[model samples]
Target chain A: MDNLNIGRHISGQFNEDLENVINHVMHMGGLVEKQLSDSLKAVYENDKELAQKVLASDYKINNLEVSIDDECTRIIAKRQPAAGDLRLIMAVIKTIADLERIGDEAEKIAQVALESFDSKQQDLLMNLDNLGRAVLQLLQQTLDAFTRMDVDAAIELHKADKNIDRNYDALMRQLMTYMMEDPRSIPSVMSVIWSARAIERIGDRCQNVCEYIIYFVKGKVVRHTSPDDM
Target chain B: MDNLNIGRHISGQFNEDLENVINHVMHMGGLVEKQLSDSLKAVYENDKELAQKVLASDYKINNLEVSIDDECTRIIAKRQPAAGDLRLIMAVIKTIADLERIGDEAEKIAQVALESFDSKQQDLLMNLDNLGRAVLQLLQQTLDAFTRMDVDAAIELHKADKNIDRNYDALMRQLMTYMMEDPRSIPSVMSVIWSARAIERIGDRCQNVCEYIIYFVKGKVVRHTSPDDM
Candidate 1:
């Protein structure tokens, strides 16, 4: 909040509106974070009830997305936000889209928990959980970076996605080896593959969130920049 | 554009700006369409050069996205447009983001083309080609709907995504069967899986674009709404 210098505005009401929107973003981020965490826990522990709860609660995240979107639109029409303030609104709009997509991925993971898996296939779930946990960490750091608008933390979090990608590749290779050993395990393992893909995408969504934060703070469009260039 | 009624504004300059932005969106959409088409051709024909061309041309789409975003920001600041105009601008902002991601998926698919595959594997590429062509048709129809701001067309296009999803699931099953029949095919088949996923996502991006068109015309948010509800 200090990084935003939100209260320095002459119009206290304008400051309040900005503060409210920012707060709502953080709140929404928290809800999405919880959803993803519960999704991961649901899969690892084979907690179908938790998975059901995660799926049921998805609408709340979706509702928040639409409402926050409306709030930003109202602010734009009322405040006519310029430059930095405008960028902040733009970032919120973009961030919420990514967050909503993240929630969708979480639902996909929760669905994975609902499916029955044999004891042998349980090993694959552990690998997915490893990737899931790494992604959850990335999502947490990303939300923290968004809260502070910390460009440095955002950059670090951005690089961390590569690790998640590497881990995802390793997990994919392992799953393939398992499939090679037992073609009978194909269908169940394919579900794990799908979950792994979703987890990898969550990492991507977090990276996109980090980019939004950097854009809000630095006014730079870092997308499409080669990793080597970065 | 008639559905948009762009020229109704009292300010000719404002109308010009609106028209210019919409035209740019159509231009960008056209470029993305070509990128997707080329990537599909590159894969089916095993044309590495076409794939390379698609990859190289991706930056143009990215650049357009940033510039168009800047233009939308400028318009909001300059016009302070309320109601419909605001919605149009918002839709443009959202649409460009999807278009950019669609370009990313196209890049993924093009990269698939760069890898050499046995003639038997080429049959899998043909299956992927069928999905790719369906998605390309959806993309074409979506762009057409966006250009006209046709709500009915948008609704139809939104429903079209289900067909893409079903096709994707079938493709996944086929890929799984292939891997199960020949375990050594796991690694190579995995790349096809990745490409199919990307193609499915392109279908999703097109659906999102259609949703934007619906939002612009119907003044509604259709996201998170179940199909039965829709």
Candidate 2:
């Protein structure tokens, strides 16, 4: 399709500008999730090439984020959408940001992997891999809820965050024990700890996305509380 | 002066539109610093009234952030700024986001303080107070650096983050020891630990702001690097 035709199609098919915004967010989400998965795999396999690919792709993600953000601004300026649509558009804009940061975090993890490519921290790296997988699962679920506008799924993701937190706490303790047992493992273990913390934070970002989804759908500030509690 | 005259005067007085964006960002930096200060101080003192004040003022901070971001976007679109101006505008935008999140983190801490207002976790609360002070100091310094466009200050703030990290690790250990020592303290200590972690993460956010400042001024990436090393 030509640019003019494409613009007309988007403007005509979508009842509100929010539909276009949501579509762009979903597109960004898909790319970011792929970045997360590939980066984690690269770290696990110690594949520098894959890590490089993730890093290179970050530029594209950054560009996409800027474009989506600009579009959100335009819509907010022109349409002044309200209620559910307004919240959803705002949430999509906010979630796109969180997703972009998640991509950056993945790139940072990949960079760390590249740094310690030949290190003897295989066990710690595997722990990070596990944490990354948990984060990926959370992001996938969060995105699903966002796309479907499923408040229940969003709530579930928020509760599931505690599980990631518990796992992260365990990982920290295990690393602390390793550091305490052998001072030699302190530096290497510290890097692994940072990566695990990064992954855990990515999980938190996903939860934030889920929270936004719930807010978009329900108009409730259900932060720092469980869905069941709400 | 009339509105048009005032606009023309300022437009002619400033060297570049980037300066206006940077100045607006500094305004946001000032606001966020106040928010962080009051929010943490309210937590430290168990001042429910002050916490309420922080909560109420947060909307203003959020609004200021939106304005700053809108200003940055306008500058970017109008001037298509490149090189230093581009990086600076981008940095300001990112810093606004970080500052906004820091405000949210501080609000979260204040919420916990409000929740445990009548609780019996004095020691844990005291540790949280210490952590809050440390994190606030780092945030203040980082914001000051951005205000002054001082790369050295930003670097110094980066080095100081290690202290916050060390404090966080120590706090985690203390919280875990408390939890193990007295199961009864688990709930309260856990809450305090989470607040402390949030505060430390706020310090990390300040570090990110500092990194962005460096990127703005020097067009360099300084993540995962220390001031001394750099």
Candidate 3:
């Protein structure tokens, strides 16, 4: 990841400060990844304690975001970096926003895990587990792509988000069927639906991060650009 | 709101550029406000053409966002303005992101209007209308806060978002009851649920924009700080 090597255009304290900001971003990403993983685990195991822990840890992620944002602003004000350096700070600022929102989504998923669901709905749980694991993998790869500054990898991950969307749609359809068949299960099924929506949104956020990475490295605005064109 | 003027430290082209960006932002806000209103009307009137127009107009909003972001980056690189000036640019950048997202949410609501719902669900539609109007008003007031840089107005709008959340929760409960009473309505009810979620998110995004206005005007990181303290 360090081999990707930004801030080479500037020297001395600017380089060091840039490195610190990157490190903080990667650290925030690590925390968000864990939150997502733990959130799914809580849902799968029905562990209310773990769910509560995920909720409590959100403040740490939020604090990290605020600090990282401050660091970016300070560097910009002090260094007055231009071109690629300016873009790097901008990218980091945007990426942290997405990371913070992803953390919020993870907290929502954890909240759903704390809800009571009938054991008969275990089938729905199994499906949600599959979707959660896939989204978790996408998030992991997206972070790795960020660390590497790998545009190709980022593009690939952008395409991968579509699969998560499909999975979410399929799960929602199945959940709807369950609700239709057993009206008593509507509340629990709705929880699963909400969790699926959160997971799907995480996929979208991961794609946004990937877009930022591509922009940072290639100096191209790949956003709203069709994937096939890339 | 105008009394909360920023970028007073450095005069000339920097101020002009900052003003240009702010004007563009307020212009974008007007577009988003219109989109939200038209989307609600589409749902209420079952007007598919109006919904399609809302969806089509999103590209224009997206283009505006890209251009405003480009202008901000250009100003930072060219001017290298510090302190309050730097913070003002940062606030605009963040605020534009939120505004773009609000446009996306409006598009989602417009998409829901394209879906066919039974006449029996008219009651649910009325509840959604109430929720939609409340969110639109919040968005309008938040934009007004941005234009005026009114910290007090922004703070008041921040508190108002909670009402939208409560209204959303109530509407969801009612929708759930309807779904349970008649399984045949699940598909249409789910569309309403999704649209309502999008509207709820717009309120959140509008609050975020208001927070940025407060930060810009007061140079305070009021986010995550308790409202009681404010």
Candidate 4:
């Protein structure tokens, strides 16, 4: 091939690598979202099987993170792309961290559910499920932003995280009220609180991913920066 | 220069760059620690000036973050160092994010202090100061780990974060109790709860830095892996 065509061939391979990495990320995201969804249902219905599934999938998620991390390193070593390509690699590394944390959160949720299996705290489970749904929505939005490379959508996810925070706070207050009214509710309420906190953390991780998308696309650190301010 | 001398020259320059990055990180660490310290004292003693100082210094800390970020990026772009050097750059970038977030948390504490300017929540402030001290110690340990590149110390910081989590839970319980007893304590107690949460977040950020240190030296992700397990 001529020099120009050689350059085109390399660029084609680079884009292919990017696609593979992004595909892996989306697959991992889907698994994590399923884990969250199932873990919440497990908690609500006391379905130990679903909870165990979520816990088991954590190892898979961890493996995916390691593989993706290795892929990122290999891509840089092999392609030696600069500037924007480098930033995309950096974003992949960061996105892996966030995705792995989401897996951990899912595992934590399962563990909490398993612990609360014998309790008559279905109400607390309902609250946790609600929190999980809100967090799941945030994660979905964040993943969408990454897939589309939509900075505005990523910003929207960042803004939506504040609502999750507010919801978390309200859930905490409700749990506190339940626990104070009846000390017998303490253990169950505390478990739910832990789950809510974990889900809220998942939301935070999603927002972290959203911030990475913005940074990946625009080289801006918009983590704590509000959308209106930006 | 011969290849041997060239090797030594690169090594020396590499060490010097590492030192510069470490020093900048330490300076940022110290600034964040002081901001946390002063913000706690400001709340406890109702020192508005101290709070204002903490808030004002945040701009400098933020500027420092951008500068350090630039230096690390510049090193990576110019040197294109491989293996450990590449890992160091990655770790420094991640560390800067954690340190910047710690600064954000300090700013948050200062904002809370400023908002509660006329409030009389001395008892809550006392608890928050205790919690803040705990977080500062965590930050200190994280900094020591970074300076020494001590994986064991980093592991210890990761484990120590659990203690901060427990302390935050206790604080949350105490605040709930106060709010339950007297509904009027809701607003002030809520502020105290948030301040304590912000300080706890700093501790978490410190642990995150420690995790990056582990990745820096060992090239491993300890997200779901506990220190004992490691």
Best by DockQ: 3
* Model 4 chain A weakest 10-residue run by lDDT: A1-10
- Compose the digit string of candidate 3's lDDT tens values, residues B68-180: 99999999998887777777889889998999999999999998889988788988888999999999999988888888888899999998998999999999999999999
lDDT of 1: 0.92
Model 1: lDDT of residue B150: 90
Instruction: Provide the TM-score of the second chain in candidate 3.
Output: 0.96
Across residues A1-230, which tens digit of lDDT does each residue of candidate 1 receive?
A: 65788877788988999999989999999999999999999999999999999999999999999999999999999988888898999999999999999999999999999989999899899989999999998999999999889888989989989999999999988988998899888888888988898999999999898888888888888887776665
List candidate 1 segments past 4 Å from native. A227-230
- Evaluate all candidate structures by whole-model CA lDDT and list the values in order: 0.92, 0.72, 0.89, 0.76
Across all models, the iRMS values in order are 1.2, 11.3, 0.8, 4.6
Categorize the docking of model 2: incorrect
Top lDDT hit: 1
Docking class of 3: high
lDDT of 3 at A34: 99
Candidates arranged by TM-score, highest first: 3, 1, 4, 2
TM-score of chain B of each: 0.98, 0.87, 0.96, 0.90
lDDT of 2 at A8: 37
Fnat for candidate 1 (0 to 1): 0.84
**CAPRI tier for the interface of model 4:** incorrect
Q: Which stretches of candidate 2 lie over 4 Å from their true place?
A: A1-16, A117-120, A226-228, B1-97, B103-230
